[model samples]
Target: MAEFKGLSVSFAVKQKQDVQKQLFWPNLKNGPFNKLEDPVCCVKYCQSVPNFAVASGFQVEIRDPSANNAVVKNFHRFKSPVRSIAYRGLGSGLIAVGETNGHLSVHSVAMRTELRHMTAHTAAVTGLAFLAGVVGGGSTLSAAPKLASCAEDGRCLLWDVSDPQGQPLMEFDLSSASSSTSVSAPPADATAAAMDKATALDASQTDCNLLACGMINGRAYLLDSRQPRPALVLSHEHPVTCVRLAPGDNALYVAGDCWVRALSLHQGGRQIAAYRRHHKHVTDLAVGRGALLSCGLDGLVKVTDLLTYEEVQKYEYPNCGLLSMALSPGEADCLVLGTNDRWLLTRRYESPAAAAEAAEAAKSMSAAMKDPYLKAVKAYQVMPARPEDVVAPGPGRSRRPRQQLDQLDRLLKKFRHSDALSHVISKGQLKRKPQQAAAAMRELARRGALATALAGRPDVHVAALLKFVLHSLGNQDMAEDALPLASDLIEIYAAPRELRARPGIRPLFERLRALLAREIELGKQSAMCLGRVGLLLDTSAAAGGLAGSGGAAL
Candidate 1:
């Protein structure tokens, strides 16, 4: 194998163009590699988030990302591709790399030249992570940072990387047993029991210790270091692509099914936020204050606000897929992005002026709520706009309750499916069973209640329309003509493509491609019809006005 940029760049050679055209070949100003022999699979920084201490490939090279395109120092060499690399924390100076040969090697970046090496699995190692510094009795404790590894052999083993050739701290073989109905579960067939036994064996390592393991089945298990068994197991519809523990926040972020879910241990396993915003498998995630950056095989990089879970920025590459991301340790605004093509990119935070502009946009939106219908109505404010205050009476007087609309708004805001349904029922919008509330709403919109109630107060307009459609369709007297229109509307509203491609709904993209095509066609037709009618009215009014003026003169 030939070396370019100090790492192996495999010779698949699909492109004959000069190396200068490839971003990875153009040595970064701060990159360490000068020669690479194989295509890099994954790269990471050893110091902190984006501070590059060591860049790993088939053979590892140690250098800082801030150093000027300098030669990489020998950290360690392994037999297989460096699939996973991790560092404990700032200043500890320990670096760990897992390779495809089922070997894990640890080196001291700031200390000894060669520290320790161990073969921990029979298959390729896929995952590695460092537990944060330990704390006990409300105070800090100092000890060697422990290392964890997951492999294709279906085992996760813990190692003491502070010393070379050291024994594994603990070992867990998750696939020791398959599904069985035996009453007397023998030791060989007792995987769960063995897991519990392992938990008890490692009880001394507990405090502030949390081990997360991702299985080949797309399941994630949170195991308490002190307990022999997993504290929680979450299954994804698709194989779990990646799992990460957030620094500082002690939160667990897992990505699968094209979504990143933030789960808080502080809240007793409650899900804090679900960012359903990517169209393909989310392969990696890096968390920082106020925001999160996620990338996947689809070559899309998205930054999202931690508080609101709204995507703030999106970047795409032509053929490169992102493999990992790290935030710069020294600067809050700087980020380091690594991709499958062996290229690295840097991004800084939005300028203060840009932030101020964003704030101004938000303020303008808040100020636009001049209509009472669009403004939030509290339970107390929902009380009859005082019947006496009305210039003319409307039908809502009898059906409207002070808290009903307010409650609907609250439910929608919280994503409380049942609560929103209760409001729909209390307002006598859906005559069907309350359990079918969401479905009823969908049915109602299909039947034209959506168009009729578009003018309703912002809080309940959507709810009322949904209710109207459901009631109209469920009614026995409905006509066949109405059915076709309702069916068309339903298909339009429920278009899978529209739902998935729309921002923040990527997790539900099962139907996006189909829905998007129909929506575009329908939109064009609607625009054409509206334009034709407007032109017709304009001409008719002009002619009538001209004729009336002449008659008046006579």
Candidate 2:
């Protein structure tokens, strides 16, 4: 039987049993840290990092919360007084401490390297995120992780830690001053409609590649790193206090004075949903499992299910307000609450669905890894004797195994060209350079018989035909004969959508354009040759026919 407590006891059985257990400071018996200060701002895990640190200006004493009687491992200066402490996910891994002075230091538990320090925000590093994979088919555990920091300065920096030097991979600046643009002289009433049209056009073409940033004046802008500047700017009724990227879709979730809004990743950050239940300013918002947790000066921790944006649970904390709140590494039914008093409280609750889902997930992972491709991929990962050995791994000038060749052929036939190309390239069966591939394609096209064989119904396209010819050409190089046909491809750009774009055509257009620009000098040389009396000039040939060229001419 599962036990329930508080007001939640009446519906205890309906909730799932959460597996994550709460262990107090360092898992010690009567630990070192206790009373929190004015407002607790942050909490995070330390086990994933080597030498994790936490700091807050509070009286230090540790108390054990676990029944296992675990011995505590005290951190160096664990009881030190500081302004605030912010923890990234996976506490055992890495931790960032913010001092009253505007500075942040990243400490790693495993490496003996010195603390990597950067003075970024003047006030404090308000929010910190370690960029672990939530999208691109990666889970928290499986994805490669990087460090991301958000500051009171309205700046976010993504640090590439894979490179020991900690290179800056991307950056987002939140402070964008509004610009004043004079209305250009236009037809009186049409000016408004024209501006709207221009706005829509720009929005449609915009790409949101960078994380969204909130401005001081309450506007949020979505930026693409490849573009010159921000792609979209969204206005808010009040200054945005907090923002986060959704785990699944990378959609922007922002909390402002009294509203928590979800903006679409597509359509240039258009508002998709907004919640208006919070009567006061929203301080921070955290997402976990299927629910969103928000804290405000209202002393409320509002839990809303993501699916419906409806309030699922509300708990009042014993403080003026919570500065920050975070979910456990396990995303458990419990939350690590940071209140204005500067103490971190671990509160547990009953949510049966969350527990059952975790069990199901555990069972699924316990099974053998599915996906046959990964196994084949692993077998192919061994380093060959030489780079060239990839193609002919075992012997001299070897051919690909019949089965593999058939697989490649079938993939190409099914229009899975990228995969087929990837497999061949991975195996080193084909050369990687674009030029080599182009030459091979041309040689294949010269073979008349191969073209007839591939011109099948409903599937025949210029691209497929060109690739077929290129494959048939094999090692032979025939650039001269291929160049003419390739040049004729300029007209094919507007070809039907069903027709694949052939490499043969584009190269031809490029070559022809170059020749036309230099035709005058070449034509002068041709005229000089005709005047030497060594060559007979035919009037009919000049008229674009061979008929006059063969006749007896003076």
Candidate 3:
């Protein structure tokens, strides 16, 4: 904490909002381990719009970007914790909520009330997916969407989500279905019936005729909306957790215990490509544009290139285990993740056009009518303007202050300690020079928030900070200024094990015996310097005037 003040922050780390959207997730300053923290089981992006839904605690929160973070009109509460949620069509037309009690309810966001409440399963509903295509193989798409849901029992049902008095359109007990008909389950025993429970469901977008559900018995039933029998059965060794069909038609992505595999529909349910990085159970998968997004108990959200099935990028939340993931509709810019904690870790990559629209909206809003979504969006780093966005300013046109939110302040406010420290170190030309880094470091230190910034990070950035401090201390001219920071480092790392074993600490802690002795010698040198200063003071009669900046630093 003290070293941050004296040394330049030439080494910093990078990651984004908790603060990026932390304002809507409840500030992390509320303590990481709250008793009331609810585990978020499901999150679903709207099928036809930008808004999304989060199933946390006993309520399903509908977050709208065009409105407030939580759209009051679309908010729906339940008697039990919501297990899954889905939206029917564009502009939040119809919403479906599946509860832990096996009860599924439909609500119309435009109507602002519950339209139907019905029993869909005997146990907790695991998932609910909307059918985007129409029935009877027509060229026209259905004006009203159909919902496909699965529960703990051997149940997978489809319903008209727009119906006021709801009755399932079709239902399935896929327990008898097997990849090879000869290898069917050995006569449904009590345990076998329960073990073959439906774990996941998905309705294909391009082919309204296609729908699929994964079972705990390691098989996925690719069902036809028009028929009673499954058109195909895809087999896996691990219990299937999630199933997703590509928009291009029939490239199904299935995730199980530790691996994710792509299966082709036209090749007699042939295995196409397999992707595995998850050491634990892969919980959910979402099909994105040219990407297949997945998250698991491994605490990683991976983005795989759709064509190659090669990992494109992965986002890690240090200690958070993810349960569900969704990519927002419209621009598909927002990535919403539901963790095993109360918070929803949302990261949005707004393109240049989106950012400008947001800025324009912010400029139009008055203080009283300020949008909370806009406020939360402001916390994140704004996307840079593209070439197409460049414009020639007209005469007397004034610039707006709508998009200038302080990045470091937002990071600190959200308790993103690691990122705050990184932001400080990344200031100015850190690699070539240290002056700007020192100034930024001093700013953080002045606020007495240095401890928060230096806590809980045990990565390369912290190692870089340690090396920066050690190098700064080697300069006799600068060592005195950095002494406090060095002491703080030892205290923070030693007390919390924040830097248990890092490249930067090897030098500082490896020669502990010699370092201790050298500290004694340094103390002796400091005493000699003070004695000389005292001699200089004696030459004048100014008692306290001579002990200015130099004395202050020491």
Candidate 4:
């Protein structure tokens, strides 16, 4: 290995190699999911088997991601649109489904039959899970008959599927609790509203009796079905989109429209940490023993380490928004994704060692490869090689990208400032291309001739220039170069009473003034925050120094 600045480079090289081996390459497993008619809302993997399920168009589909010719089972007895699906735990061969309308269904996988149907709620069912031994003062897994379901009206119902009469075991109205009571101090106007819907629910892996229910109006209700009310209510600023309980820790993750926050279960759902990279709605979350996986409408799938609360890896697919995803248990399997465009995608993950072994095996068995038509063949020239018949190739060429720059430079050299300005920045009359024309303004500003250039422009040309500068000032990347130009333009145009008196230019100048004032206020706030942070650092350093001196004296 080569040394950089006389330092050994072995560690950095090894790190890079490890990263390459861990990277996952994605490929389309099946094209658009044959006969798929609607966007998928849920993709969940069975805890006891390799089969995964997808909810789409009032139907629930079960298939294996690792097989190209896997048998698929569909539940076709739904009377309403399906929203979410989950396999009943304990290898029970049962599945529960929630519908867009307020209804629930339970089906036996082997019998291909509906065991129990529920119509207890009057709004869209958002969350569904089984509470095997955690309901009605508790029982064993085989004897616990309660299945929990919640809907948009914030009503949670526990149904006894085994009781042939089909009556619910208990019902809890989570909306009755104050939305912000769990905090030390909350907003004055915080109250429970009738429309605040229940969004998601999950039970603790270690203590199955504890449940967390997420609501649409930014509240999370911690509940124990044995009681009649929520244990605690946690509040956030955005609607809770999804929630996942950690298997090994007393904490849970809640995803909202913007960020995903981790709340401490032992400390009454207080927010302990958060992660944010998605700029749109975070749609779903899946928790494993050691990692947290999230997919969002921004088309990003993030993998995070549960122990450190740090991002491990992320993949961004710009063309499609992901609605849900399921990670198979082992690395040998593949990841299944449900997209907003009604497409099911899957791809396998391979480590470097596994990939190399596969390559060697294929090379030794090249003669018996499946696609024999793709085999490499020996080739010979059909015609005799002749230098005279082959004409030398000419250099590839295209029109110059900087032709506009040349035209602007020629106009500037002639010192026709107004025509040069118009040559680049006019979108007047009907249409415009200010970007193509910004070249003229940039050159004029560099020469300190912008004032002279703008002296006698008409309303149409002035309007276009003002609009471009306004748009540029709002963007961070272009703001630095635009700041000084904007200052000079405002001084020249706004100070002139005659120009301000004109109807077209007056409104434009007022908007510029408002933007400048807002930017100034924001800058002041940023400076104040920096000062406070600096003071905090200084205080911490002084305390550390005094402690060191005391330790040395002792």
Candidate 5:
């Protein structure tokens, strides 16, 4: 009998490079009620409303995205610093905030008043989120929402906001279960007991029925609000900074230190994949249609494919450490990022074809607006002025002869370093020829002419050069030669204290740091391999000597 088998199919996925347009709003340097003590901690877009909320220091500010001016109204003020914020129930006009003083407050957007405030935790609240499909249904618009908050105290609490005086509906003690077992173990097996204790605490939830809490002790707990104990635990080497549930899927994405891991909720909370692209702690994550967007202290915003687990696009801002990120609920293409310096940036992606068409149209319009007389002269085949046509030089200096003047003009026509670099980049027309440009720049660096060429260039040109050098340093073929040159160039053009504080300088330094780290890690691994090989060779030689002695004795 013939047996049926399933075939696995795989395809090479081509990356999409979309043209991104960015806009920056003025920094919100001051909080609504007081001077901000820290950068904005959280920014959340309302799914059913036009406004978004930003939390910083002791206040939450609500701002309209469509407004022409950059003004934020003081929505709610707390006694302690607001560490995290989340919007509850679509179009419910309700916002929830967690504070450093371990207090949780729910505020009504339309009423502009606190609906309820409770002592939610014993320590600083690290995360706040509203469970999906728990409130805001039917014709009544006043349904109470359920909230989940986690804290440095290693506990996650679930609260029902139906009554102002009610206590937390449930609490998940992250330390209790594991601590008891370790305490009962024998002293001789202390190490084994500690390991067992850790394994017990690292739990996570696979379904929406449970809330995942990332603890400061490098463990994530999944609490079933209906049950008194945790349902599952997930462990990490570094403290878990953030936890997010994938929309419409039973998967969780956790970010801590420099890594982000995807875990399956249904498969006993097993980790599916881990991405370590960011060089610093991942500050925030926003999941979109088929991609996950992450921002980090390294000043990079990366979009990773959910299925392939590969980075599709990366964006960096100079001197800016991204602290928060939010995707517009109405538009997936619109993303708002908050920086450490209090600048809120919006990035919108447009179709590459459309951008190209717009550029072409603008160029044609400019050409048509040129002097009509010059256009007519060109159309009639009139002879334009040439170097040889000049009879005499201007008042600056004495002119020798037309031939000498022409020779001087020819010398001047030779491209400067910056101009030559630009020409090489543009030679491939719409597509940039990066390899050709990199080769030309490498030659310039070798001749010690790159610095002279870059001396008076605009900031944009310098930024482009920095990007090129970084990319070259990442190439295995060019890295050995490019590393020193790249370092020198960055030190000269980018390392000044004031320059490093510029809007775009931080990311370059971060990329350089990441490259250096990779080099160091490679060197360490190579050394370890060499040591192992030597040990094996020495062992073989000793065994051979012993065998020869034994044979001679026989």
Candidate 6:
């Protein structure tokens, strides 16, 4: 069972078990991106209005969510390509646009005219976001709004959009700061090294003062709006493409290359965990109610548990590389994805009839295992007995020396052949008895229980057995004894292509491959040395035979 807060839930209860659903875009009635001019660069949802904005080519189109059949005429066009777009706040219709020409423009959606235009960056601006407090809630729109933007020039600029005539409120040279303060500098290509540093930036939605930026050279920096210097820095092997601060402002989520990593800000920026399920670059991430949503260039959208880091759901869109993603604030299950194919796809979770069928099946399974003795036996076979379950000596009582053995005998009689062997292997390992475990494994192999276990639930103990085999093979004394068992187990468990592709199993395959290669080389060298020794022995024997013949003749 797993506990969350003060509530307990069964581990068998999958996150998506109750919500068996399919995701489809309802707005694709007229076809995907039929009205948009070109491929989408970015997408964002507006809070004040029931519409969404998409930047395609050099135009930013604002469309009504209630009517997705046609595009609205209310859009802002720029002379250069619009790389990024962001809304100021909930009640404010101000839209901020960043262009590839290093130009930043603030426009009013109601007026459909540019209010302020300035050269905020020397290169293309890649990211734009407003401070969390500047948007949402019931806050009045009377105060000036602050916007953060990152550009290819390696600079993160802060602007007071309210005063267009004034200069930038703050400027942070990410490239210079990183070069001077980074503990270990990352290797970069000539072009990337020559470019101005910062590549991406995002303001935290929970804390207005917190901001995060990613550099082209695989570094992520956390910044405080009140301070000029960075608060913390993180490095990755691949270029950092995106960085997002969680809603609590204590966790930072970063995506780069083919990985998504989480860092705990409260723990001085220690990495909490990393998820590498995506096959390509993870382009964006959105924090939902209790899950983290990520989209990648592999056209996979994965939903992972924030606490456990377990992937709960996955959606695949073949041949389409996702570049941007946004979750609807009004709908927890509603998600919008901007693709390289020039389409804005929206997905919403809807319950299906399969959920009812699954529930019925689970109920039947529970009913079948209702017998108390059978249930106990099944449980013992699946898991090792607890330490407290062993009968120990008490005050004024003599300890039963064979209590565990007696219990094992009773279980062995109650269970089937295969089941008994599995129980012995599991319990022996837990009890830290190597000889007992080896004997159980041998019995299982004799009865062909290894194949049965692999087919039934390979995830349960297959990895454990694999690790044990590898350890034994590494030991010079036990390698010969463990060779046959290791070969049989690997042939059964590693035969499936899908099983080999699993994240946990892939590393084991790599290690096995390297170990086998080394052993083959050593075997060749040993064979050559033995051949040389045989030649020397034959020469000495022939010489002794000639000497003996000479002595006999004399």
How are the candidates ranked when ordered by TM-score, highest leading? 4, 5, 6, 3, 1, 2
- Write down the lDDT of every candidate, Cα atoms only: 0.53, 0.46, 0.66, 0.68, 0.62, 0.67
Model 4 stretches astray by more than 4 angstroms: 1-35, 69-71, 89-92, 132-145, 176-194, 329-333, 363-554
TM-score of each: 0.50, 0.43, 0.55, 0.61, 0.58, 0.58
Locate the minimum summed-lDDT window of 10 residues in model 4: 181-190
RMSD of each: 22.3, 28.4, 17.7, 23.0, 17.4, 17.5
Instruction: Please give, for residues 1-554, the per-residue lDDT of candidate 6 as tens digits.
Output: 11122225566554543332223221212223343567777877764465677788888877655564246635656879888888655544778899998899877766677777878577788888787664432323346457888887667777777674745777654654243322122324547544535667888766777889988788888987776588887776568888878877888888887677888888887777875666457888887666788898767777777656766666656567888887766455457788888878776543445547779899999998689998788888897779999877678777656645554456444434435545655664624755555555565456443333332234545566666666766778656645666676566446454354455766675677678788889999999999999999999999999999999999
Query: Which residue pairs in candidate 4 have backbone atoms (N, alpha carbon, C) closer than 3 angstroms, thus clashing?
Result: 424-437, 427-432
Worst 10 residues of 2 by lDDT: 196-205
Backbone collision tally, model 3: 4
Give the Cα error of residue 274 in candidate 3, in Å.
Answer: 1.1
lDDT score of model 4? 0.68
Worst 10 residues of 3 by lDDT: 1-10
TM-score between candidate 5 and the true structure: 0.58
Which lDDT tens digits does candidate 4 get at residues 319-434? 56789887775442566778888878765665667878989998889756646344323233245769898656546544445645466668778666656776676434113644
Ranked by TM-score, the better of candidates 5 and 6 is: 5
lDDT rank order? 4, 6, 3, 5, 1, 2
State the lDDT at 303 in candidate 2.
70
Q: In model 6, how large is the Cα lDDT of residue 99?
A: 93
For candidate 6, give the lDDT of residue 544. Answer: 100
The sequence of per-residue lDDT tens digits that candidate 5 reaches over residues 11-121 is 433222121111111111122222244687788876666667888677788876656214455764578788888775554467888888778888766666777887846
lDDT of 2 by residue, 272-323 (tens): 6776544356877776665678887655677765555656655644225666
Error of 6 at 437 (Å): 36
- lDDT of candidate 1? 0.53
Across 17-66, the per-residue lDDT of candidate 1 in tens digits comes to 22322322122222222334544455455434334533447656554445
